[model samples]
Each structure stands twice: as C-alpha cells, then as structure tokens.
Target: AMHPMRSEHIRAAVKRARGNRKEIVNKIEESLTHCLAREGLEGEVLGREKHIYGIYQKMRGKRRAFNEIMDVYGFRIIVDKVDTCYRVLGAVHNLYKPLPGRFKDYIAIPKANGYQSLHTTLFGMHGVPIEIQIRTREMEEMANNGIAAHWLYKSNEEDQPKGTHARARQWVKGVLEMQQRAGNSLEFIESVKIDLFPDEVYVFTPKGRIMELPKGSTAVDFAYAVHTDVGNTCIACRINRRLAPLSEPLQSGATVEIVSAPGARPNPAWLNFVVTGKARTHIRHALKLQRRSESISLGERLLNKVLGGFDSHIDKLSPERVQAVLAEYRQSALEDLLEDIGLGNRMAYVVARRLLSESGEELPSPEGPLAIRGTEGLVLSYAKCCTPIPGDPIVGHLSAGKGMVVHLDTCRNIGEVRHNPEKCIQLSWAKDVVGEFNVELRIELEHQRGLIALLAGSVNAADGNIEKISMDERDGRISVVQLVVSVHDRVHLARVIKKLRAIKGVVHISRVRA
Candidate 1:
C-alpha cells in the first residue's frame, strides 16, 4: 500500500494471516525438531508470529509491498554451543530446499548491535518461504534483548563477572566514543543510527583479524575502523594482494592492508564514500585540528613580522605586555588572540600597534608607501575596488574586521576613509613579488567570427593568463568584452594591452578597476 492504513485494517490483516502463520510455524518446528532428534542433536525449538503493529511498522519503514514481507513466520533453534547451532542450521537446510543468497552468518561476524546468529530462508511445503534462525542460548538472549540481556541475568555488579558479554560492552563503549566526537545532540543521534546498520560485510586485516563494516564501506572506512591513526595517515591500500583505490567498496573475505606514511594526512574527499560514523567523525576532527594548528602558526608569523617593524620580537614581549594585549582584545588568553589573527578573525598589525602604544613607545612612521613582501600570507588581501598589482603605488587600509586591504593610491574609494589616518597604512610594491595578480580590462571590438580567438592568442603571446572573459553584444557589429587576466607587474599588463590594441578588430582597450 502507498499509504499507511488504520489500526483496524492492520488488525484484520493479522487476524486473517494468523491461522496460516501458525500452521507454517508448527510444520517447520516439527520437521526441524524431528530431524535434530534423529541426528542425536538436542536443543530448544521455538516459533513466533510477529504482532500486527510490529509488522505494519516494519512494512512502512521498508516501503515494501505487502506480499514481499517474508519474515511474518519465524522459528528459532537454540543450542548449547556455537558449533551445535551450525549443526542445527545444516540439518534444517537438508530438510528444506534453501533459497540462494538468503543465508547470513552473523555468528562469525557479529552485527554492530552485538547480534549473532545463522539466518536462513527456505522454501517449504506449497512453496511458502519460512525463515529459520540458529544460535546458542547466549546469542539468543543477545538477539532478543541486546545489551539489556546482560543486566537481566546479573542482579548487581558483584554478581557479574568481568568480560561477560564483551562484544555488547564494546558496542556500548563505541556509542560513548561517538558521543564525545559528535558536534551536538542531533549529530550524536545521527551517528548512533549509522552504527546500528543492519547489513554488513566481513573483511580481514593483514593480521587476519575480522572487521565487520556496513555493506558498501570503502577502504578509508576500513582504515578508520582499524585505528584512528591509520585512517589519518593512510595513503594507499592493497586489497587481496592487489593495489586498489581508497574509494573502492570492500567485499566480504577480502584481505585489506593499509599503506600509511607519517607525513600523510586525511583528504576531505574521504567524507563522500565513508559509510561508518567513526570514519566521518575522525576525519572531521583531524581536519579541524589541522586548520587550527595552521592558523596558530600563521598568526604567530604575522604578529612577529609587525613587531619586527618596530625593532622588537614576539619572543621578547614581556608577560605584562602580552596580558595588556589580551585585555585590549578582550581575550582570555594569548593563544586565543593569536588563533583569532591566524584565522583572519582579527588583525595582527592592529594588535601590535595597540601593544606598542600601551608601552608608550614611539612607533616609526613611513615617509612614503611601505614596501610589501608579497609573502604576508593570510595577513594581507588586495582591495576589490582597485585590484592593485605589484607595480602600482598602493596604500594599505586596515579594515576593522578584515586584516589589510591594499588599494591604488589614486582610487576614489580611498577618499572615504582618508580622514582616519590611523586606519590608513603606507604601502609600496615588493622588490620581488612572488605571485601574479588579477587585473581586469575592457575592450571595444568589432564583432566578427574568430575575433575572440585572436584576442586570446594575443594575450597568450604576451604571457598573460586569462582568468575569465565576459562579452556583451552592444549590437551585431560591436561587442564590449571584459577580460580578467593574471599578470606579474604593471609593465607586463601594459604590454598585453598594447598587443590587444594592435589586433585587427579591436577599437580601444583600457584597464578596468575592480
């Protein structure tokens, strides 16, 4: 049914199927018990007919057709030992034709919820499908009540022995581990759902230890399941003695060997294929820590560079000076301030200026634009309004939240904040700027076939890298083209513009701001 039905409808359906279910269960239990007795096997045989509400809920959850629900009639055979359970399973299979691919051996590889059993669906009299479960008494208790089965047997801690239900205890411990790693309550609950996955594949490690992961899990998931460190440093892996991609889905009984390097780190792409909550949580935690550490280092360097301008150093700063800076920023500690700067949450130079001002030290003033090193890292960003290049005479404006913004001195946008000299910093081009800068140009060209190609070729000839090109058709004959190109310096950009002007169809070319 596409929609859920009323309670009365479900009750009526269960009532109609009750007699058939009882007959099927009785026949299967009789056949199994008789077969086991003849084979000199001793165990308890039980049968169950699921309640109407339980069946309805399961059907709705799985969105299965009414006829597709096969486990309405179930039987369980409980033995004294694990081996006896397997013997019961083999005997049951011999009595009835077993359905292909309809058997699961959870005894060898327990489910994440600590469920262990041998499940088989077989075709019985009149082609009716019946499901049989074979397990030991202990496993029967676990499959029925999960972790609560342990508490039901032991009245108190003193009555319980250590390592009793160890697998269930480990599952509970994993829940706590996920809780600690999750960002919030909702995330913790979501991770718990992933841990309770019903379908799984059993794979082996190089050491021959079995790992039961959810079906469709990748090599990265296996790595994390083995150990967090292994997942973090995993660079490559060999599956069944053959090299395989990390994203490849692992198969049952495959021997997986992780190849890791000390310097290797997690890739963000691992989050896409990993099915286990443990892998996703560990990767996210590692990446966050990595970002924080990098930010701290970058912040420290930026602060030291600013201090060096005043003939001082970060290591030489006294405790009192550091405390004063922290107080100025309203930060509880120095690391917090440094981390904020490193993450671009605060400006390093501003903090340095405030600290020096508090010390009653006269800060040196640049007579003209201060030269840039182009290697300021996260501490400096070019102003979008002017898009200053290396050869331009630029002024540095310290935005309140943004670290530093470099703009051409003649930019009209500079006039708005020029009254506040404290926010205005002198800047000049570095002697050896390391990287190219983005510059935009506007070209008025006569529209013709292959004209765009000619323009692109000319830019390449002048060693300019085209970043983007947007064209507007003013009319069929004329098109206004905007090009964004990467250049080393003003001279290189000027050469590119000259080359573009020499093109056959180009009428005029001018540098566009921003």
Candidate 2:
C-alpha cells in the first residue's frame, strides 16, 4: 500500500491498513502532509470532500447511479508558485501512467474564475483512473477560497503581476456589471456558464508569452487583452506569420501578433462574436465613444447646413441663452441636445421654439419639424399589414408613441383610423428621397421544378435581396408562392413583378395586401 501522492504525503503509519475505512482517511491526510512539506509549496492541504452538486454532476454526466462510481474520495494539493506547479506535474507524471487526453495544463491558461492546476487522471496500482492535480501554492490558496486573495496578500503594483487568477476574476466581475445593465437574470447566468466552460485554444505571442482564449477567438480579442490602447488601434493581425482575417478562428497552438493603427476604433458588429469579457467591454466602450463623437459631428454639420440656409450663424444664437434653455430641458450639454436633433430623436423646430422664446425673438410658425415636413412624416410609414412600396398611394396615421405610421391608403385598417381623425396625420415621402423598401408578392405557378430557380434568377436580374420565400401546393397543377422581396421603391417593384410574370408556367403575379 506504499505509493506516491501529488498534493500530500501518504504517511508511514497508514500503509499497514490497506482496506480499513479510518486508515484510508488517515492515509489521505498523510499524503497532504508529504506534499506540503516539499520545498516552495504554500497553503494548507484540507482534503476536499465531494459536495452533493459535484456528485450529481458526475452521476448525471456518466449516466450512472451514485453507487456505481468509484474514487469519490480525493485530496487537494495546494502550492505557492506557478513554476513549482509544473515541477509537481513532472513529479506526478514520472510516478504514474497518465491516461491519454486526461491530462490538462490549466496552470498555464487558468480558468475564468482564476483556478489553475495540472490535472491528470492516472492509472494507480489499483488499476483505476484516480484524478490528481498539481498546482503552485498560490493557486492552491485561490482554489480553497475564491475572490478573497485580492486583499489577503500584499502583491505587486504591476497590472499583470497581480496574478492571472485575479485578472480572470476582474474580467468576470466586469461581465456581471454588463449583465446588470442588460437587465436579464437568465442571460446573466448563461453568460457566466459560457465563461466557465469555454472551449479554449492556447496560443503564444512572438515574445514567447502564452495566452489561452476561447476556441474560435479572433485576433481582435488577443489585441484587446494585451491592452485597451492596443485594441483601439488594431488594424491587422497575423497568425503564425501570415496575415489573417480579424474574425479568423485561432487554433490551440498558433503564434499571434497584432498590427495596429494609431486612430482605429472597434466596429459595433464585433459584439456579435467576441468571447472574452475584456474584449467585449473594450469594444463596447470604444463604440460608445465613437457613437458620441459621430453624433456630435453629425449635429454640428446639420446645424451649420440649416443655419447657413437661413442666413444665420450658430454663434449669433447666443450660447448663454441656449445654455439656459437646455438647463430647463434638463440636458447636460448643448452638443448632446444638438446631436439628438440631428439623430431625429429630438426635433430641431422644438429646440428652435425653446430658443426663440428664451431669446425673446419673434418668429412665425416654422415650415415643418426638421425631419418631417408637417403632417408628412406623420402619415407615411410603410405598413407591414399591406407593405406598400413607393407606387402605392400611402396614407399616414397618428399612432400613439410611434409617431406617424404609414399604410397603403386602401389598407383594411384605413376605416378604423380614418374614422378617428384625432389619430390621422399628413405624411409624404420627400420628392428626392431614394431607398429600397421591402414588399411581398404572391405568385401562382405550375408545379414545375425550374419555376423557383427561374423566379430567383429574374428577381436577381433586377437587383433585390430576397427576404423570405415560401410555397404551398394549391392542387396537382399549381402552387402558390409567397415572396417577400426588397425593391428600390415603387417603380422597381413593377419591373420585378413584370419580370417574374414573364417566366414560363408563371400564371399570375400580384402584390400581397392585407
């Protein structure tokens, strides 16, 4: 019964009783002593008893009953240094035949919660896979008590030297902050799960430093983890000495380097895929600042353009009076108010009204709100119920909270809103406004294999994005297809309908209306 234990020492006295229950417990305690006495290890070796949750996970994961599983009794080895952890790993590997793929080097990468160790499932003399973990004394301390080591020990002032576990904890706490702002508790818990069980890839920096990140992580994540300033300016990235897409997935052992630009900022779409909290937070922060800057620039441009048309200058409006009016509105800054006006959230005419009243300048009723021309913006929304394009005669309704919602003048709900003039609003598309709008069309075609392909080709020939398509058999000879497609306003809608109608066996094509 004599054997080597990694975290603790199996004492001489316990070796005599091979099958005694109390003696087995004593042997585990003795193993802890042997490991703790080794040079350069720190922390106490308190055998960790398996909790209910841990037992449940093992049983459920293996689809086995509680009594069928073996080796529930395991002892934890606590150490004080990262380097010592590797040495202990070497010692254990030398002593046991580690089951292939059962050895994990978490000491180098660490977990989201900052736990790090060399974990191995080894074939002991008893011919069973016994789990053994080797860790530095510091890692052992963190495992016993989570998140308290930040103040428990006096540490270096350098950012990274505070330990990877501390860094990981800070990152998780930041994620918790974001989750609170998101206001979804379920989503918050789900995000925490993602952080914990992340499928990870380990890569090396050119300088020989190692980084462990979630699998499929991009170079953008790597850049941000290096430093926020570096992330902000990341222009390009190289993996293993070749230029790669910023969104390219990283392998477990690639070498990565970031190429940066001085003034580059993160794109908003980066939020769609980034895995780490550090990268996510930095990208979100950069995007927020960028949006603020963009809004301010847009506002200044619009104010200059509008005032220039009126033969007046923004400076002539008197900053003091503007500030006073803004204070009444509970706005903190003039630029913020101006940005709101430019973004169509706040009407310029309203701000103008406030300004005119405060400055004691007599002015006539304005032509229209800055974005909407009178009842025009109110009555001209493209209704999902009818999906009217530009060619359709559209009417506006004064929808509560939604401002003006437009519908085809002949929309089925027209009677309901028309009867209530209080909810009616005048609206029209400006003469030169140009953009693509979605419209749904119903097509009747013979049951032919090429019909769908032909229709798709015709639609593409006219340049449109297919939003949705579905078909149903009406009978043996015909099928009715619903096509939700986009067009450059009303005139283009006619062209596409005509084209689809020209296809062979296409009997009829007409717009779908409520």
Candidate 3:
C-alpha cells in the first residue's frame, strides 16, 4: 500500500503475478471441475495460448478485436486415452452450453497435416466463448511440435513409430514424391494446387487402407493416388461395391476400387474431369508422348508425299542433307521436323519446299488425299459438328497446336476454307476405318408405352450403340427423341436409321448435322 505508482512498482506487480501463474491455473482447473461436477458431469475437465503474442496474432489474423478472443483457462483438456477425451468433452459441454455448428470431430477425418483432435466452442460464464480442444498426450506433443516431434522423440521409443510419427513421415514421403514426379516447376505448382483446398475427404481403398483426398475429388483422383500405373490403365471404377462412373465424385467412408484393362491408356477427355495435379500432369504427359509418336508418323507421310512430287523419298534423302535441313528448321532431328509438321505448328508445305530448295525443282502439290485410319491417336480428332464417318467425303483442317481435325467436305463451318490447301487438305477414309463415330439423330414418334425399349432394341439390332438419348414431349400425344448413335460408317448409320424407321408409330427420322 505504501509503494510508489511508478515503473518499478508495476514491474514488481507483474513479476509477482508471473510467480502465481501455476497457482491461478490450479484454481481455474479446480473451479472448472467443480462447476462440471455440479452440473452432473461424470468426468473431470482434463486441460492454451491466449497469452499476449498468440492473442495479438489471432487479432491480426481474424481481424477480431481483443475482447472477441476466446480462452479455455489458457489450456486444453489433455487425457491419457481417447475414451477419456470424449468423457471430458461431455463434462465441458455440461458446464457451458455449446455454440451451434462450432464443434469439429477431427478424429474421424484428420486435417491435411494429420492433426486430430475434438474441438468446440462453448458459451461460458458471463456469455464469453470458451474454445476447447480435447486430445491425448501424444496428440498434444504432435500438435505442439508437428513433424519435428518425429525427431524430438527419444531414441527409446524408436519402435513406436506407428501413429502420429508414421503419419508425419508419410506426409514427408508424399511431398518428396510429388516434387520428384512433377515435369517442371509450373507442373509442380499445378499438381499441388488441389492441396490448397481447406476441406478434405477420407475414403478407403478396396484393401481397407484409408486415403485422404481433396473434397470433390473423383474416382480418377483416387486411382492416381493408388499408383500412376493403375491410373493410366483404369477404365472403370466401383464405389462402395457398385459400378460407378470414373468421373463420380467420391464421398467419405466409401470403398473405391479401380477396374484396369491390360492395354488401356489415358484419354485426353480425362483431363476434363480430373481434379488433382498428379492426374492432370500424368494425363498431359501421356498424351504428349502419344501425340509425338503420331505427329512424327503423320509428318513423315506429308514430307514424303511432297518429296515424291520431286522424284525423291525421305529414305533417299542423304543423311547430311537431312541434318542440314533439320538445322535450318532449328529442329534437333528429322523426327522433330516431322513432329512439327504433324502437329500443324509448322507448315508441312514450307518444310517440304525448304527440303527441295537446293534441287531447284518446281513441283506441283502431291496428288492423292491423305488416308485416315481413325486411329491417329491424340494428333487427329474428328469434328463434332460434322460427325464425319468413313463413307462421308471429308477434308482435314490442320489446326495449329491441335494437329488435324477432320470435317465433312460439305460442312458449312469449313465451306470457305475447304479449298485452302495450306490449312485444309483433301482426306479420305482408309479401306477399314477401325472405330465408331458418333452421329446425332432426331426422331419424331407417337408417344406410347415402351417407346424407349423399342428404340433401344432397334438400335441394338442394327449393331449400333446409343451413346446418349433424350426426349421432349410435344403435345402429350407425340414425342421427339434425340439419339447420339455410334456407328462404323455411313452404311452402318443407314442400317441403324432403317431399323429405327421400322419401329411402330415412327413419324419421321433424319440425321442432325450442324
């Protein structure tokens, strides 16, 4: 009482309060337990940095005022077992009513960093919020030191690296794998972008091993996480023991199994559906490799046709001359030059002209149309608008960076450019175009029971697959059906149309071209 109101007196007071910190903690715990017991709680409140710096950081981070900050007697509940942790949580709630939607059970779905605890905020005495966390002692140590705790653990416990320690080690391993597998820095950055998602879902493999993925991740992401090879060859998936689409978004607790085929490869369309960086990068890399091989092949064919006009062939061109041309084009090899021509990034005509410039040959363009086998991989794609099949008259549009896109010669989209030799080329289907091409059909029919079954049966009878189907009711008596049928060629399409025309109550049917 006689002390002066100076800096020395304030410092002394602060020192004395610091000495009483443990006593204050004991009293707080005692009062907390007493309050919970009074409220009929069966367990004790087991266990925090609302101290100056932590409080300041929170204020800066959340833009919350100092008064809005919550405290739990500046400590969390620490128990010896997971079961006791729940009991303590019940006691805490019995003492203070909980804030709605403020509880998080992270033990079921751990955070991306492998942190697991039960967290909640309660309306404490005086209506202040008390944020509480309940965890075991091991979790407390892991939460405090993170992965560093792996190293900090005493050597005597080296064999107990099964729980938090193993998880942290696994996280390190995953990071290293991601870094090593990235094609470049930008690819690495793209691959890791999914990790930035704050929410994650936990699913199980068919083998019962738990896997964590970003929320909204699909079966494709899960497959890639299993292994790159499994992803590359995966054709279908089973989610929770039922056949599911590869694009189906996975849910927590589901067991996912990938169905792989021996020779299946990644589809460029997969890039449209996949969410993870690893799947995207791997798909792109595989497509790039596939495109290179296809481009080199197509490029060689184009160059040889031009060379044929000059009474020369690629095989006959001297190695030195080829190297000189490669240097002129700044291409490392003949394949590189061909790949450029194939991809349409560099004009085939220009490269052909340069190759024969030394011969002073005035050559007319090569005569025959380029043949399409329908298996040109990623470098060649058929136009969706025209839906050109094997029997349709087609022309190739050399789309830069996208290789070739084949369109019907009569397609309105390419009418102006059909005769432009540089960008468009005459193209014809080979004797055997190997794959099915999608053709849209519009059918008007009297609405009747089992109409869908009849149409499906007809298409199946004609050996056609309906890729998609939709119907619109016109007047409640009539309906218009749109079908996307996949067939081998125009003849095959005609057969399918004939089958549809035979169905009862069919009004009119026609192909849809756009």
Candidate 4:
C-alpha cells in the first residue's frame, strides 16, 4: 500500500512499522537499477530527512499542534542534466506508488525565485507516505543560495549566468525600477519586500512562458510583472482562455492573457486588489502623475474663470505681474500656485485678487459661474449625496484636497457653505458634457411576481444600466425598491422613470437624494 505523504504522513507511517528506515532507504536507492541504469540517466540519492522548526513560532504562525507538524521527511536527487531529472522521476514513481495530483514539475514552470525541481509524494511500504524532490546539481545549489549562490559557484566564465543567475539578474533589475518610481524610501522598501515573499502559484503566458506569482496575486500583478506599460493600459484579462475579472486570484498552471487598449489608463480601483509591490508602486506613480496633470488643467480653468470677471484673461497678464503673485504666495512657479488653487488648498478668488493687485484697488465684478464640461478628471467629483447631472442647476463646493464637489443647487448638505463665497461657487454644465451620471432611485411598487424582472426590462429598454438594486418589503402587498442607475443626463433619467412608470405594478418613483 503506497501513496503520497507529508512529514506527518511519514511519522504516522513509521509509527505503523512500515519496514524500518534502512529498508525504505535501500528500496529508494534500488530505483536507479529499476529505471535509470544504462540510458545515461543517473544521479546521487541525497537524504533530506525531516527537520523540525521553532516550536513557539511554528505553533503561533501555523496555529496547529506542534506534534502534528513533525512528520515531514524527504529525499533529493541531483542529476547532471534537466532531462535526467524527469527520467529519474519516472524511475522513482515506478519503485514507489506516487500519490495522484501530488506530483509537481517545477522544472517546467520554475518558482518565482528561480528554483526548479520535480516534487512527488509517494506511499512507502505498509501505507506510509514519503516526499521527494529531484533536480539538477546546479538547481540544488541555486535552490539553497538563490542569487547569492552566484558568488559561491565557481563555474567557468564561459558558463556564464544564464538560467538561475539570469532570472536573479532580472529580479534585481525590477527592484531597481521600483526604487526609481517609489515615492520615498519607505515606499521603495515596502514595495521591494513583497516580491521577496514566497512564490506559491506558477502561471503561464499565452506564448508558453511560465511565470511564478505569489499566492493571492491577481491578474494586475501578472500584468505588472510582465511590464509597467502593459499593466498601465490593461483593461481586462483572460485566464485559461476565457475572459476573467482582472482581480480574480490566479491559480497555478493557468494561462493568463492581458487585454490592453490604446489610451486606456489604469483604474484607481485596481489598487484594492493588486498584491504585488511592483503593481502597487507603479499604479501609485501613474496616479500621482495623472493627478498632477489633472490639477494643472483644473487650476488653469479656475484662474481663467475668475479672471473673466475682472475683464482680464490669464494670458493678458504681464510676466512681471504673474511673478509678483507667485512671490507673494511663496510659490516657485505659476503652476504651483495654480495646483494649490485647484486642490482648494488656496482660494482661487484670493489668488485672482492678488494677481490683479497692480491693476487697481477696485476690480470689476467677475463673470458668470465656472462651466463644468465633466472632463475635469480626478480633481472634480460630483457629490454622492445629491448625484447631480447635466440639465440640473449645480453649485461647486471647494473642498480641501478634493478640488470641486458638484451638487444640485438645492442639495442641503452644502446649504450652510453655499453662501460662503470662498468655499462655494455657482457652476453651469457645459453644452458638451460627456459621460454618464449615476443616480439612485426609490420605487414604490406592488409586490407582484416577476416584479424585479419587469423593472429591469423597463430600465433596459430605456437605455439605462442598473448598477445596484435592493428591495424592501413594506408589507405583503407593496415593496420599495432602491436602485442605482447610470444615465447620460437628467433627460435620460426622466426617460427611464417614464418607462418604469408605464409598468402596471409601479406605484410611484422618485430619485433618492440624501
């Protein structure tokens, strides 16, 4: 009776008296004669006996009984070539019953740290389990010392650093790239340390190249591991030849293909699921750059908006006047001053006044409210409370670090601050506002069979997308449904509501504002 086993399995097997350790050892050695005697396939049989670990640390980290973990034991065979490693595997499995699904050929798909070997679990005599590893002699050394083994191995210079050493060099090069993009020393170390963590899942690319990623890593991690550019523009991923979520946890042996789009930018949401330090570091760097560009654009718009009222344009201002404003604000450049204004750290109105200090003590009243084209990017956000859309009268709230938060003019959340000229300003939707707006709706409807389906069909027919929907039973006959829907504008929303109102069971519907 033979199969695969762990250290615990070996300990349990020994307790059952499965021929003594010497008999097992002799049988394993005899595997060479059974399969690898003449075909230039031979290697040294090395004993890798069970080794114990710190009791307290193992107990605390594994949260398992100490005695249960002591059953591990295995053997390692070091051959001369990669092909022989596999041949010996056949020989060993022939001698001992190898456990099904317990065999792993890391040689085909090396670990992230560049370690390659053939691992198998077998059942020895009397139902005892045993673990074994087979690899080339160089692999054994590389496994033990990793990149540091480079200095220890005294191979001929002509041998060069191909295989393990090359992988190590590539890894080191990645670390240098992370260091360059990291925001600070702490960020660099934090990002670099995660890559040093153990690589547990091995995956493959579409081109048959194997990649080793840490367990729990996502496709974004795989994308970043491929290259920073690929990661930045990746819109989706295909795992194992099928479209999969970018945040899906990767499993070993799955083929991953990243789908990229031209001009597509990294989603800030990816930060939530990305596990690799490289992905995190690169995403943050890209976002920082994106925000800087957005801030500069927004700052220019704000300055120009205010200058409109004083009957002056930012371009019309003299260089000396601009320099004086920067000096007064202790800003090194006009861009810095504008960024501050864009982020709401400095009031644009105040800056506008200072920029015109030389003109005169009295300045003409500013023009109409700033127009929002819905392209302000990260600096400008719509208030979640009111969910304002185009065609609605909106006001801008100057929130520190948030730039502008747009809300319906009637939204009470900003009622107190609305009167404060420094913190709030009127805003008008530009004629060419782009993109959809999300709004939550509460629908009172009769509790009828297939009610949800009807609602969905109606909204779908009206060209509206439902982001989320929840139902609350008011009683046996009536129910209230709350749904988050995306529409292009107020008109689009009205159209969706009208379609829903046509349904027989729908009692009433109104947009949810809070």
Q: Which pairs of residues collide in candidate 1?
A: none
Where model 3 places Cα greater than 4 Å from the true spot, the runs are 1-47, 50-74, 77-193, 268-275, 308-315, 412-416, 440-461, 465-484, 500-514
- What does candidate 1's lDDT look like per residue over 1-514, in tens digits? 3544666777776677676667667777788789999889998988855666666777899897555674445778889998898888888888888999989988877776677889998887778787788888888777778788775365487765343366777778778888898878887887778878646889999989999898899999999988989999999999999999999999999999999999888998898889888888888778767766665775686677677778887788888988977886899987778878766577666778877786787765423455677766444788877888988878877664455678888888888875454566666776878898999999999998887788899999999999999999998899999999999899999999988988988888888874
Task: State how far residue 323 of model 4 sits from its true place (Å).
Answer: 4.9
Whichever of 1 and 2 has more lDDT, that candidate is 1
User: What's the lDDT for all of these models?
Assistant: 0.80, 0.66, 0.79, 0.83
Q: After superposition, how far is residue 66 of candidate 4 from its true place, in Å?
A: 5.1
lDDT tens digits, residue span 1-514, model 4: 2323444554564455434456666665565444566545678876565433343345568897744443434678888999888888887787778899889888877766677899998876666667789999889888888778774255578866776677776777788889999999999998878888665788899998878888899999999989889999999999999999999999988999999988988899998998898899999999988887888888888888888887788899999999988888898998888888888888878888888888677655456878999988889999999999899999999999988899999999998998786788789999999998999999999898998899999999999999999999999999999999999999999999999999997888998885
Ranking by lDDT: 4, 1, 3, 2
Cα-based lDDT at residue 201, candidate 4: 87
Q: Cα lDDT for residue 463, model 3?
A: 100
Q: How displaced is residue 326 in candidate 3, in Å? A: 3.0
Worst 10 residues of 1 by lDDT: 362-371
Clashes of each: 0, 18, 3, 7
List the candidate numbers ranked by TM-score, top first: 4, 1, 3, 2
The runs of at least 3 residues in candidate 4 whose Cα sits more than 4 Å from the true structure, single-residue gaps closed, are 1-46, 49-51, 54-71, 79-97, 122-130, 151-160, 184-193, 316-333, 358-365, 440-457, 468-484, 500-514
In angstroms, how far off is 393's CA in candidate 1? Answer: 8.0
Output the better candidate (2/4) by TM-score. 4
lDDT, model 2, position 129: 44
Q: Model 4 reaches what TM-score against the true structure?
A: 0.79
Candidate 3 residue lDDT tens string, 1-514 = 3434544544454455555455555665676778656755444354454445455556678798644553334547766778777777887787779989888887665666668799998876666566778888778877888878655354466565666666667666666677776778887777777664436778999888888888888998898888989998999999999999999888888999999998999988888888877678777877777788999998888778677777778898778888888888788878888999899888776777777777787767878888889998878998999788889988989888888899988899988777876788788899977998999999999999998999999999999999999999989799999999999999999999999999989999988886
Strongest candidate by TM-score: 4
lDDT of 2 at 230: 85
